[model samples]
Target: MNTTSHTVAVLGAGTMGSGIACVMARAGHRTLLFDVDETNLGRGLDTVRGFFDNGVRKGKIDAAQADSAVANLSGTTDLGDLAPADVVVEAIFEDLDLKKETFGRLDGIVSERTLFHTNTSTLSVTGIASGSRLPGRVVGTHYCNPAPLMKLVEVADGRHTEGWAHDATLEFLDTLGKTSVVTKDRPGFIVNRFLIPWENSCIDALESGVGTKESIDAAVRGALGHPMGPFRLLDIVGMDIHKQVAMRLYEQLREPRFFPPPMVERMVAAGDLGRKTGRGFYEYDDNRLFGS
Candidate 1:
């Protein structure tokens, strides 16, 4: 699909969803961002606005461009509003049943030509598509966290995904100035295949008193030239999400290294969900990391 001339509907209004909406809008597509509640939809819009504002401040985009992107972006509380979309991307929670249910509902609402994409990082695209009326139209378009800044989107072809659907998704993402890698429908895909295991190891080390979070993060930063250490990345990704992904990968790959450590479970159980919740492996005040 030529997304430039079409409308893109993004389901869910969380961080990833809102950020993906910004990317679509900025790419000159009329983007409809949908959520179940008014507050989440409003928050998603605000996040898009904030991204544009920051882009202008950083000279990444001019005020005119920002205005145009914002003009192209709209928020909706009704699933029915997405019927007119040419492409629908689901950025809901990481649960398989929930994703399948969402896609099943969307099948009834959207046109058969409307391409269905899921922003699932670990779940099977084939499994999600199995619940859809048109499984051949479903594909996985997994955008990394903070989608507006992340340039790489993992495109996965499910067992039933048609060649045209996969090709069109790649073309659409390319038009959005995103680099994509095609991967078979598998747990964790490429980036997470390497990332989740490393993170699991980092948690194990932390739990074993290998080093303090600060020292370990600093060592990785200074020695390995990493942008952020595993712990900090885990915190940013949300400890609960980290644990969930780890468990999923472990279950599928049966790799001991992918298992979520006890510390991660305890932290998630404690409701320390990282930046969003103001606590996780580290403490945050207003989303700013204050202490370990």
Candidate 2:
């Protein structure tokens, strides 16, 4: 594992962005969480700090370690501020053009050897890499939600990705205590291909009166050995996001299993999106967005 500290920049200040920044900081990297919106940037910084502070609260880490990790993280609005970053991980909106444009702009700001990682759950890595002059450095790094807690990360090399960049990305991820799973640069990669359909089926079970969400969740945890049940996971993922991802996959692969059930549409339309909205398959006391 690499012991040398590196400067890392995470674009976008959403749930995924904050989580990734937290991981980098905890690994002793100088992490800059960037966003164009000042309010989002501030919120993201707070979220990153919260992860460390909460770790100390739960005794997952010592106070000094939490404090040190927080100290290593910063927030920025200026893109040029990331010039010194050795690796840039983007967790922005799921817009192909915007993703491409960000990479294109970043290519000129950062070093030629800097790795460009896109945490895109949908969309093509090859398509995103097209925007970069250094396409060889662009790789798809789809981090699981709650990036700090999730051990698995799906890595996909674009058509033009260089072996050096791919190897370096794996090394960097290892330093952050992540397990990298190499996959083809296809839509949904590996996790979503299985996750979306399974989630939809779980929702189906609830709709068909098979069992209450709680009972079903419990059964899955006991039988399938999953950390959390589908409903609970969907609540964390947000109903709207799940619906969007499901619909997109269905449209692309024409798979019936990828289709979101009617309950998803109803919940989304009613603004019961998830933890961010304080409700989904379940309710939360607070409206704060969870990791991813």
Candidate 3:
């Protein structure tokens, strides 16, 4: 893995944002995690620290390595603090207008050469790029959930995205030891296009009494060669997020398979929002945002 340090800023202090920041810092980059809310920012920072500390406890990284990664991470409430960033990754809310407005506002802050990467899962890259004056520099980088653990990153170029920006984005992901898969700027990119429907099917199977949640998860892990079953993955992703992403794709594609199963509504309503809420398909001792 490349250890050369670079200045990277991740917008939004949510689980995804903090996870990506942890990945960047672990790769020796100076990562600035930004959020408008001070409380959220603090919590996000704590999440990142928890990830590094867990690595030490698990023996995945030594104490010195963990300390170095933690030292490379910082939190900021001010967007102006991101001025020195070589790359600014926008992982804020999934709202298109909010994503657009963010890149537009960053135009005045960062250098023209800085890459603007939008982590929009359902929105069009072209639509988000329309907000920025430097549309050529705008690229779509959809990181799988739990960014620190996921090795694959989907790289999609907007209609106006320049070849230089696309190349640079791929290179940046490489530095972080991430596998970059070039994908179309379409909704869900590569992973979600298949994952959402498959997850829905799994839910349907469980709901229809074809198998219990444990049996279904075990079947997937044992036969399909997945690290975790649909239920376990959903637990990490949060049931609310699955519903939102699934519904967004369904609404856009007009596909019945993209619709989340009815059980999703019940789980979300019950506040069983996966690990973040201490329960989803299973229970957790603590409400950590991601798995160790």
TM-score of every model versus the real structure: 0.90, 0.95, 0.96
Q: What is candidate 1's lDDT per residue for 163-193, written digit by digit as tens?
A: 8998898889988999998887888989898
Model 1 residue pairs with clashes: none
TM-score of 2: 0.95
Q: Predict model 3's lDDT versus the native.
A: 0.91
Identify the runs in model 1 with alpha carbons over 4 angstroms from their true place: 287-292
Please give the lDDT score for candidate 1: 0.85
Off by over 4 Å in 2: 1-3
Over 4 Å off in model 3, which ranges?
Answer: 1-3
Over the stretch 122-225, how does candidate 3's per-residue lDDT look in tens digits? 99999999999999999999999889988999999999999999988988998999999999999899999999999999999999999999999999999999
Q: Which candidate wins on lDDT?
A: 3
Q: Write the per-residue lDDT of candidate 2 for residues 55-134, one digit (tens) a residue.
A: 88888999999999999998999999999999999998888999999999998899999999999888899999999998
CA RMSD of all predictions: 2.8, 1.8, 1.7
TM-score leader: 3
lDDT of each: 0.85, 0.89, 0.91
CA error at residue 75 for candidate 3, angstroms: 0.6
lDDT of 2 at 163: 94
Q: C-alpha displacement of 69 in model 3, angstroms? A: 0.5
